[model samples]
Target: MTVLSQEKPLPKAKTGEFWDHVQFGGGFGISAGNDYTDITIAPSAIYNFDDNFALGLGLQYSHLKQRNFYNSNIVGGSVIGLFSPIEEIQFSLEVEEIHVNNTYSDLYNNIKKSFWNTGLYVGGGYRADNVTIGARFNVLFDKNKDIYGSAFMPFVRVFF
Candidate 1:
């Protein structure tokens, strides 16, 4: 059997009505507050399964060229979980890592060194339409015990 009917095409729903969604953006970061500069060109993606459950992934590649500091290369990713306890507010947990080179300074030319950096972060944000502002605390532990070993990094993110 064959049947044909004519009807108007349905319009897409607004952001509030969609059950699933994705987001993409670029990111840049630096190690210290300021002494040298490092940059990253990153693209991040997010998918929401429902109002209270979501997942995300992000990739970043960084290049460090010596102007007055040591040169290095960095690459990384993040797997994120998003949940809502109350309306318009969401919580997240991220597992991420970065790799860089170890340079022997003029002061410590005879020392042999290597490093691999890793961390986990937990944060939350308030969502308004498509934009969010949030804060995170990252506990970073470095390999070089000779230098400053570990510290906590508190940073804020603006995402859409």
Candidate 2:
């Protein structure tokens, strides 16, 4: 008599794609001196669509105080996109709009004013496993309200 044996098939593994659909990141910085003080907090979120690209949004809040002359608040939002062709490099583009409100209180006078700032930034940088360091230029820079003094800005990003 002869006996026949049967083999069972292996089960498929989960890709973890659904759990990794969203990415969160942000940065914070502060600068202060005798005549002026500035603090900023920026938070962002990105939806990973595929392996190489993502679409996202960000919000920025800034508080500025200039000794005894005036105080200002800046609130802004950005539509951001990122592309990575390889494992170690990335290219980013963002469209940002900022609203600035300044209140002046000096001697016996109190005044308030508001303004809008819009810019487009494009840049590329080196990327690590969970961090990116880069420089970007505001192609659509406005001379009236560009606080950075120039069109070039440096950035460091951490991913979670």
What lDDT does candidate 1 reach at residue 44?
77
lDDT of 2: 0.87
- Judging by TM-score against the true structure, name the best candidate: 2
What TM-score against the true fold does each predicted structure earn?
Answer: 0.64, 0.80
Provide the overall lDDT of each model, using Cα atoms, as 2-decimal numbers: 0.64, 0.87
- Residue 149 of model 1, lDDT score: 37
State the lDDT at 14 in candidate 2.
Answer: 63
Supply the global lDDT for candidate 1. Answer: 0.64
Best candidate (score: lDDT): 2
**Candidate 1 has what TM-score?**
0.64
In the order shown, what is each candidate's alpha-carbon RMSD?
Answer: 6.7, 4.0
